[model samples]
Target: MSRLGVLRAVCVAVGLLPALAHAFLVNQWETIDTSTKRAQAAQDVQPGRAWIEPLTGMDMVWVEGRCFKLGSPPKMEGRDGDEGPVREVCLSGYWLARTEMTQGQWRRVMRNNPSKNRKGDDYPVEQVAWDDVEMYLGRLNSFYTGRVRFRLPTEAEWEFACRNGGQQVRYATGNSAEQGSWFQRNSGGVSQKVATQRANRLGLFDMSGNVWEWTQDAYDSHAYKQIEPQNPLRLGAHPFRVIRGGAFDSKPAALRCSNRGFEHFSLQAANIGLRLAAEVEKPVKPRPINLRDTLL
Candidate 1:
């Protein structure tokens, strides 16, 4: 047979084979295409509390967890007494608000204005105490069908999420202040609207500056040194809670992910606001069962 004739015969055989098993072949291709589509759809999905209902109303970003060195090195430039003795810490996955809680979100949930100085609906809601935030979360949880809950991130979780699952960067986004953080060099003397600055790699907006975020754990400068890697360490049953990320009025050094501050749970400040954390849900596995033979 000629080479061209042989090639045509091979093509005819291949096409005829598909016709012989058309239904099975079509079903297999459909399954493969469906799986591929599902996987592609998952890639577009964000992680953590952002996937839950109530918190989903606000734009949130996922922070994949890992072990990272926490705190400042002794030789770091402009190091402060509070940044302290460096240490290693491990974190679990979490979601953080893309921006500080805006007055709009606060009003939606709490239904009252607590901010002493209201700038605009989009501005970070300030003058909220830690206790007030907890109260707000309680109400939000009830309003959202009880499926989702909200509370402040623990100190370690706050820092880990703010760092966007990476080691300390000069600012939360990166080393450059020109990247739009409201710090000493660029804030121009006042707090700007939330989300006005560049977002961190995790898509969390205004992590470096806007307003300081209240953390669930209490403050202690040496707290990290003694905490277990599996669990975040909390200082004594103190009235004060940790606050992280610098405010609009802060200097560059203050915005470092390692920097820490403290305030009483009931104390409200113009530069303070709250971001929420909720538990991550894991897929439930089905249990295997033994079926004994039964007589009918």
Candidate 2:
């Protein structure tokens, strides 16, 4: 009722506004992901050639095909129940982006940067959703005249690579999260430039933390129970898609190779981003009747 009381009320409201605004932005991203967002590659693309997108400078790294154990060991500390029954999975060789897609790469393809940390072009681009990534891939596919096929790494592929093609290290690189990953205790509350820390044995950087990487699989609590031997349960319909590794704000426990998290298909948060996985082209072989092929 008094002038002083009204002034104090206004001051208090103003003080609360920033926190409320941040929360609103965090909650605003609530939508499902789409799987069929990419256009088919151009018919003339030479399937087996190593090609580069001119704008992004992203070099695709080849991960060889193999049978590997998937999921955390039951007795491993910080392992979640959902990460079991620790089945075996076999996968074909494929290409994956060597680091999280950078802001420069995203901007070159999408014409805008949505990352909260705009400190540099090399910083991992965050604030991206699965749907947004689909659009980016659609455009990226078109950019290379369909010669390049890029999509999110499946949860199995991601975990396999983070484990260094099945070496089974706790984090992607080593036992100590502080040495190889950027998490709450080390990241200073923001994403740092990629490749600044030590890389994994596979020569991939930022696989444990920095930002959570989106995968192609839809989130399902029971899906792991029905595991197939090869490329299991990648395509599907679900409310949320899987996101793995962890983010700068995460604690070390979340950065383990088997730790899993899910986000609504459309929820783009400051700490969520993506790495790219590519479809592999089977090598063409000459027919047995060909004399030259047999000689080779």
Candidate 3:
């Protein structure tokens, strides 16, 4: 589902979108008056490289790392109480799946499909718990001994990529949820196939709606302050883990880029799925209990 051309176009469009190439701090999402502005935001998202993993035929896109404020302003629509006490987050470049991990990919490795619906191979695999996802990654890693290791994205990284390199946007497809997402308004109470809708500026699909994506961090309403701002990952044996993006039955407000959701670590639901993320050319290392402690 990766749009190779969009990644290639980033190189051609970089000069045209100089403002985007450099990070500018915007305090708020600001009001979007017309679709023209939204259209321009989508066009200006000069993304990085993209490639496909041959083993599972998974399309991977490179998310170029940059720093930006990590939560929503207090007055923003759909603002959650936990989104406040915003902090800046700087990340390192990493590979992210162009779409949610599909049932086909899950079955190809695990030898069984765990999704409740089991619609087909192309559908996003749901009913996966956090530990189940970790097991899948473990099985996936045994096949490839290369330096690149597969895992769930950290919430910061997920939001950074979802916001199109940390831009002050509301959704992956821009402020409008209608353009490239399947939500309560039009989903008819069902999740659609991955990439059935348009991709975001970074050539990623289903980041706003379709299914809730599990992340590496534990859920903490005060996570922004609990973790370090750089490559933030809130690690703990917490009861709940962070989940990103909304589901097919989710309201548009729930799909906001900064929206926060959490579920018991073992909870599995029809609307929850997982996306793959990876760090390349290095052996996987453990994240710190407190990211700030590692720096000291």
> In terms of lDDT, which candidate is strongest?
3
Candidate 2's error at 256, in angstroms?
0.5
Worst 10 residues of 2 by lDDT: 32-41
Per-candidate clash tally: 0, 4, 0
lDDT of 1 by residue, 124-193 (tens): 8899998899888876655432233456888788777667675667777888656868876777666678
Candidate 2 segments whose C-alpha is farther than 4 A from its true place: 1-52, 281-296
Clashing pairs in 2: 31-266, 32-265, 33-265, 42-146
Which runs of model 3 end up more than 4 angstroms from their true locations?
1-49, 281-296
| TM-score, prediction 1 | 0.73
Query: Candidate 1 or 3, higher lDDT?
Result: 3
lDDT-better candidate, 1 vs 2: 2
Each prediction's TM-score versus the true structure: 0.73, 0.77, 0.78
Q: Write down the lDDT of every candidate, Cα atoms only.
A: 0.72, 0.82, 0.83
List model 3 lDDT by residue over 1-296, tens digit each.
36645654685666644444332223223432333433433343223556665556788889889888999988887799999778887999998999999998887666567787777889999989999998989877655545467899999999999999899899998989998899999888877889999899999999999999999999999877677867889998998999999999999998998999999889889899989997764655976598788789
| Residues forming the 10-long window of minimal summed lDDT in candidate 1 | 29-38
Ranking by lDDT: 3, 2, 1
